[model samples]
Target chain A: MMDPLLHVKNLKKYFPLRKGFLEKEKTYVRAVDDVSFSIRRGNSFGLVGESGSGKTTVARAILRLIEPTEGEVRFEGMDICRSSESEINEMRREMQIIFQDPHSSLNPRKTVFKIVSEPLIIHEGLRGKKLRRRVEELLETVGLKSEHMFRYPHELSGGQKQRVGIARALSLNPKLLILDEPTSALDVSVQAQMLNFLESLQRELDLTYLFISHNLAVIRYTCDTVGVMYLGKIIEMGEAEKVFSMPRHPYTKALVSAVPIPQAEQPETAILLEGDIPSATHIPSGCRFHTRCFEKIGAVCEEREPETYCFPDGSQVNCHLFKSTALDDEAGHGGGSGKPLETKDR
Target chain B: MKPVLEITDLKIEFDTFEGTSHVLDGIHLSLGKKDTLGLVGETGCGKSITAKAILRLLPVPPARLVSGEILFGGEDLLKKSDEEMKEIRGRQIAMVFQDPMTFLNPVFSIEEQLVDVISAHSNRNGSRKEIDRKEAKKKAVALLGEVKIPQPDVRIKSYPHEFSGGMRQRVLIAMALSRSPQVLIADEPTTALDVTIQAQILKLLHELVERHGNSVLLISHDLGVVAKVCRRIAVMYAGSIVENCSTEALFNEPFHPYTQGLLNSILTFSKRKDAAQGIQGGIPDLIHPPSGCRFHPRCSRAMKICEIEKPSPVEAEKNHVVSCHLYPVRKVKSF
Candidate 1:
């Protein structure tokens, strides 16, 4: 198969902590460590993780919003990560981002017209009547009218403000859109509207999306391929349906099972992780999920990080249960009580 | 079975500079003794306002009670004096807000706050038990332990910021349970926590309610969260209760269009193939709300009568009720 629209290879981002007055050594917050994924043309690739899991960091790193420590972000065959200044500036035209909170992300003082047209003016140098027409057209595409272009950001409702944000993101007619918790701040009904609009927009524009959200249902609905992150690592990645329906990793199963169904009763069996996610500043040595993973393999998961295990169905999981290799029984990787963990605990 | 709390024809209005915002348009609900009722809705939908009205937490100057009575265990809370309401606030009807940080005093330790609440209720009105700080401390530690807070004895001395978001919410729950109040109103208790921690907190609430036999008014936007803890759910849309029914009936056969819209918006694992759809229009402005049914503008099956006449609650099915013009045959004549 040909390479996907976007290929992110082993991206790493480490934020160095300020050294204390007396201490000589400094610590680093490994925000996004050794993460890799790809989004096919016009397909949304979701990145799901709890807060501090570094999903957002990966998105930012790919866009070069922050200087990534290492790795390559190849966008449409161009290595944006290592590209020259002029090339990156040109690359920015084909890529844009929509933030989670439109209220904060948008300038309160700027009218909807200015907010949406600013991107177009910066990139294409459209002016006056042309710019206004473009802004109105963009607004119309997002289901807003020309009349709304004059209103300030604060005047618009939460949902309407998000529409303006979308219009602005689409001003440049970008091929790839990085949506960071795009619908999280909106209400339930409003979220539905935005999600539908996003779906329609994707189909019409033939855009690729890197949808990042902690909400599993949103990801399940919007994303085609999914990557589940745990402590700055993509522990699982596969087709959205398979990963959600048949999660292999313990953390993935717990996340998948923990999603509340709007039914009367919960499922009988649930893989409830033991504690809160550990702080990212001091990530666990091997398999950061071991601290909370209820199905942890005796001592192997704690000491050695499991290598990526590829299944027959094109799914990848970083878990010991699916550790497909010659293993000596004495090493504890092949514990006698091994259940070959899937969704259920033995 | 008698209701632990009953709210009848409860209407609330907020006087803003633009106009009078009709926040709660005649909310009617009853919590049976030892029952958990979930009041679910989107933001600014009056679910939170209803919760505030129950405790008289809304500021009187800005918020006016247009009409209706809040009856608590056979007595009208609206009629109670300020002094009497004070006694009832913490001891009779305890409340846990959404954010634990804002509700909890950051300056004080958990022990101090928990002990204060315990002692405040124990000594309120006319209780024979003498107020003892030591006993309160002991009870506070026990309450913390009941909520599954680790090292309760040591953790009790820590400040609120020291605990994680989930743990702080558990602390708030512990404080609410500390008084052994007859009614516990948890308003979006787990909204601030992650899905995993939300599960843990939800389990804690269910267990506490079971053990204490306290009626709960669980208000949340997430339908799943409400469904897990509540047996019956009241779906509010634009300051009005559009559907109130058993959790099973609401899930299986939602009568109201708004309720159906909410259910469809959620993409459940089991229903992956079903496409998600939202109500077309935004909520009507409360300042100038629609004449008859607030949801009429967005309803797919809306008729001319829906625009002219407000829908009365109709018995659509067994243990299921809806306020929509679609079910005119089952519409009851009761106010």
Candidate 2:
């Protein structure tokens, strides 16, 4: 197998929660705590989680839009997290992000040409007719005509605006693109077009993508590898098809069941998790998902968090059920708990 | 089965500075009692406009219902006077918008908002002596409880901003259901929410409508959301019902090219990870729409007939209807 294009090891980002008269530091909101994964060259890695699940934070951390507090991020064997100021600036040319909200991402004052050409001006030092031609070429590549160059962001529809955003990201000729919920804000019909464009662009440009979305359907369709996160931890990661088809973690199963199958006559009885997601500042003891988990084991689950266990097929799951079986054999208990363990957290 | 709300040949136009935007043209939908009808369309496809037209809630100067009748309980809602419509608005037909913050008053407490909505259509007359504010407050709390808001007693006293985005939406839903309207119009109800919250809210709406024996007209841009809640669906394009069929039929065998493109676009995580395809090109300008079929410019299977002629709705089966030239053989025989 070829070497992975990007490797992330124990990536952690914690936002400070400040309060009081002096605005003293309180607790930290563990946004993207200890997430680790890699994306192969020309392949897409999808990060799936509900809102506040740190999927966006993970994407932002990869782009270095915000710095990571701990861990390593290697792009093509070079540690981007450890790079100097000048080195990081040059490295940005190879990594770019497409924001979820197209309207807010683009500068309202700038024309389409200026928005698309800005990256080239700063990074490549191209100017005059040469740059203008490149801008038009990029726009055309994304399906926009030359006439759209003069128009501002407000003139375009949601789908067109998104295409312009895509055009801007492609302007830099980045090796990897971080798409943060790119199509969640788009209409279903327009979303399809964007997805197809992304796929084709990947083939033509040999681009790698780190796609972040809460939509399971979108993630399933676009990603080669899928990571399911909850409370800043990746509970499951594996081949997109295998993980989705046979989700090892109960949370992954619940999330997959949540998505409405387009035409299936009998909708599956969703593994509905009762109660709202707990506050990140005050995370539950032991497993982060134990409060909502249906197959939680007894005191062991509440006392000790589960670690990732790799399967023969390269699938990895961070769940007590998978861990407890291993522990039972080690302890010579002969795999007989007899019944499903009821956790104290529940 | 007679439909509780029937909109026939509905046409709406917005007079903007640019030109007259033919927003909704020849829209026809029928919502039967206790049945859920999904109004699926892209942004600016007039799904919201159609919903506003039903309650006569379209902003006056810019929006005008050019022609057609919106019949509710055998009466034309389009012809209803402002006073008559006010009586029917919350009592017979209530609507929950996408953003609860925009619809909810920031300064007002949840209790005040819920009570105001209940009293607006309540039969209790202007006798202050007979009307109990405490009773109304209790009813408000109960309504909140029905929507599954925890600690409804305490939460009702808090302002809209105090609640999370999902909780505020629940509060809005509670207010809409306070009067126990026969029909509820949810326009992108879960668009702004997270997936888990969206799932919870969708489930709640489905349960509430069933328990109350009320019908729902769910308008959403996401087909996934619609498939989860609605039994039947109406696919709208360029302000007209392009296809109407059961959710099962629409997903399994979509007759219209637009519907097929929409289904193919949705990325199902359990399926293959090939990038979902999107319909090429943007929706045409409503003011200067295409001469015949609005989707002709982007459609891959466009025919010569689609260029110059509009297709009328042809009944494909007992209740299924589609408006497209491609279904010519079925149209000629059915029509």
Candidate 3:
């Protein structure tokens, strides 16, 4: 709306593969290829995909944890990718990340106080009483008792440890937070608590989040906007409600269908995608989802790559069925299956 | 129909340096022959402990079942001696753990592992002294086939690491079935697997249990997995069965706040368009859990009565049992 707080344009991250004798550079694994999305200030934008979908790569690239092969990352209208070292350091103070694994993300040897205060010490140059007070305040904000500040990571439960992670992220008082599957490891009850805490924290702190998770349910609930990534590309992107209710992309539909309903009698037949997710190194030509595409739209889906078809409602899908050309051609002659391709086959 | 397994008021405690951590607090469960009971809970809820306690496999000294009756076919397993329990472990109740790699030996071939399991069970039953190695190998291959492992014959000779994570889990399931135990305990069997692989394994397990007419205890953090495989669901909290009901009932009108919270937290594709509502507050410290209701600290509708007194098991409806003070129909019990 007002030039999104963070603008990611054509982000691409490729990991080089080395092979044989002299260790010649082999082919590069295009982890995050031509991915672009922006997050509004204080709004949560979710990135959903399976393990190798490059959702994590996009998060890391935006955080500058892993340098992108090519693209532009603008944070608060400042181009982070091209920023000088001093400028980048200055920008780092306003952005932070909370990793998936709480146990590993935290230093096992360090106490909770040290862990949370580490950020403040490095960025704000506060120590001793001031740092301890700040750390306690952060812990209190995350729903942890002030006394828990002295405990080590191992002493705390999975949920408590995640709280410590959250506290550390907030210690820097950052505007943007990148949460990478923050609740995947916790228990359902605990996961619920964490999600609630995150929502409340976002509200109170007015934080912007680039939430990355394989869990569609969490994303559906927490994010204001949603982006579904397949392989290295964003196949679908739109408002959270629009994307969830009316998913246009076949991959998105399959993903949505895959979520398990607690009480309702699921259809005897699930939209079971055959085979494992293909290796990214050897991506199929054309539509990345062609191999598992249940629609089986035939050769066109596997021959020419589809472009993102933007809808008036702000929803976008990169599928052949929605291509403006196809729609226009069909409308002009009233040929082919003039019907808007049924999203759900069954 | 007689239940294949019944556990009554089971309590497990771990002796740690800090103190005796009361892990499993009076957990009671029952499963009819060929029934699938889904044990759903978050991490450290003691869902896995319930399974381990059934097999008497918990590490002693630090781990001890204070009181409970694990009755399999009317036999009180807790009262049974260590030697007696060993006989029941694989022969009557078999288990498939979460991680296949950790459960499987890397050095040994798949065939060797499966054969060893069969041999061990057979030896316990006093089947034969001179075990036929070749015949055992054939049986192992067949077991592999039963679990739907592709290229079973060739794959049987490969080491555990050679197989993918899903395939290895399938191998473990096959090994558990070799004993043909009346009850199968699978603890987060598909957590490490992909969704497609997880679906396949769930289907395979469902078919195996139905065809064999054996009961299964499916333990997992995922309610979706439970919804697919289990006929009945047991919602555990802080080592206690907070809610137990038929799958349909649990999903339709969950009486327990914890169960409702859990169900709401799980996001399904059908409801992907809707926002997910997660439960508030973290789990209480088990060692020093809340005085009354373990879940009271996080319960949205927690009352002063809930904090002061524990609620007894109330028959909320037909086949639905809940432990919460909110339901006026239920009486509060003192801890």
Candidate 4:
């Protein structure tokens, strides 16, 4: 499929907890454990999960903003994890990240002009008037006026500040933009404007987006492919429409049902999970979602993790309930161009 | 339906150094008994201020209540003395704040926090001798259990830091409902929580409010959240309620231009043809809002009269009311 823009294979990021005095055993919080996904060119891939589900960690690991413990992050056929420092720095020009909070992401001290111009100056070595013109162009591209360039971060409103952040992210002319909860901080009306602007920008620039948000409705609106993360593991992945409409995995079902729609009439029943997400440090055995899974079946779920089961419509779910589907697909294809039976980990 | 809590001609101005900010401009709201009414608005729309004004919680010099009557249970809450308000605050009109972590004391155990609320109520009522520590502790556990916090007995001893955000919110709910208040004001209660957790909290709130038969004033920026828990919604813009109607009517046939814009701006899961265009321009500066109608500058359907004269509330339907020139009150025709 035109060599996916970004291919992340088994990306794992673990942060080690401080060791106690006279302790021999070392423990680590597996924030992003064995997460693998590929984003096709010009497509938006949404990563959705509750807090501490490692969605942000996966984004950081791919960009090498935070180093991955193990995995191959192939961006345009270049291994980011294995690339040298200089090579990675050069690659940074192609991939940019838009942080969640514009309030904290933008430096309060710097004017909008400086914030937008810094990347251009650092990368292209443009000078004086040229840089000013470029910064103004970027600001205008993000729907802000040239007049806004002189204003500090605090001087601008929430929507304006976010536009500046977007303008900064676009300054490098990056092919891929990892937007982490871009609209969560915005007001509803402003969020709508931003979403529409982003969609138009994507079409105009031919950019690939790795959009991470906890808001299902926003994700559904912005993304093409959706991945549901639970305690550092992607339990389900498929087309956004399919995944949201007919969610297979129990976690996905619960999550889809959990989203409160704007309509007055609610669904008859929602599968309410019992407790909060388990700690990343102490992930539950077998299926990571077993602790709170509503549709869990017997000992298999508690004993062993399910293999990735592929459907005819290109959706993949990791749950034992779909075990027979994978077997049938393998049987029909005779192990030739079949979708499901790739288990290198086993 | 007789309104248990009524706010009429409410006008509040914040006298800041940067000129007088007319925060709340002639707001009118009514909460009937056992009503679950939502106050939905964008940030700086004075939703919180209105709630604060009801409790006389706004600091006076900076925030001057220019004119208003907050009638709670046939009495003017605005005119109530501090002591009288204190008696009514927790026992009658309870509040659940947005951020539970900050509202809850970190050092105290959940049990201690819950017991303190109970004891405070008793001490204020001049019945301090009736309820002891043991009785309060038992009631605290029961309250925690009622909010669906797992293992209330054991969890009650744990500190605020030990509980998750959802659990902490549950504790706050328990504290708010401890004395069984007549009215509960939840100001963006689930805004800080995750979607799943928010669902749980909303469901709990819906169930509890239904069970207790307490009138609730749910203030939130999210229409979806308001839709889930509230039967009636009051859409606030700038410093005024532009529209107030039944949840169904507001969603299906919104009368006000700003209300229509706000609804159109939200991205719903259900597929639709047109993209949300959103409202143009930011919220108006309250200090020098607009010439007349506060929303006129941004309203697409703004008429010339909208700039010259402030529109008064017009009954669009039996219960639905909107403050807009589009739906001007029709003159009664003589037979």
My TM-score estimates for the predictions, one after another, are: 0.94, 0.91, 0.87, 0.96
What is model 2's DockQ versus the real complex?
A: 0.58
Best model per TM-score: 4
Span of 10 residues, lowest total lDDT, candidate 1 chain B? B267-276
The DockQ of each candidate is 0.66, 0.58, 0.41, 0.69
lDDT of 1: 0.86
What class would a CAPRI assessor give candidate 3's docking?
Answer: acceptable
Deviation (Å) of A13 in candidate 4: 0.8
Better model by DockQ: candidate 3 vs candidate 4: 4
Query: Once superposed on the true structure, which residue ranges of model 4 sit more than 4 Å away at CA?
Result: A329-346, B330-335
Q: Candidate 4, clashing residue pairs? A: none
Per-model C-alpha RMSD: 4.3, 4.8, 5.1, 2.6
B79-192: candidate 2 lDDT, tens digit per residue:
889988988888789999999899999999989988887765565434434435778888988999999988899989999888888898998898888878899999999988
Q: Name the runs in model 1 displaced over 4 angstroms.
A: A325-346, B272-274, B329-335
Mind giving the per-residue lDDT tens digits that candidate 4 earns over B226-308? 99999999999989999999999999999999989998999888855247778998988899999889999998988899999
Write one digit per residue (lDDT tens) for candidate 4, span A1-346. 2678888888899999878878888789999988878888899999999999999999988889899999889999999999999999999999999999999999999999889999898899999999998988898899999889899999888899999999999998999999999998999989988998999999999999999999888898999888899889888888899899899999889988888777778676977878998889988888888888878888899989776777656677888887876568765522222232221111
Residues A288-334, candidate 2: write the lDDT tens digits.
Answer: 88888888878877877777665545666778788655454444322
| Worst window of 10 by summed lDDT in candidate 3 chain A | A337-346
lDDT of each: 0.86, 0.84, 0.83, 0.89
Q: List pairs with backbone clashes in candidate 2.
A: A192-B277, A192-B278, A193-B278, A217-B267
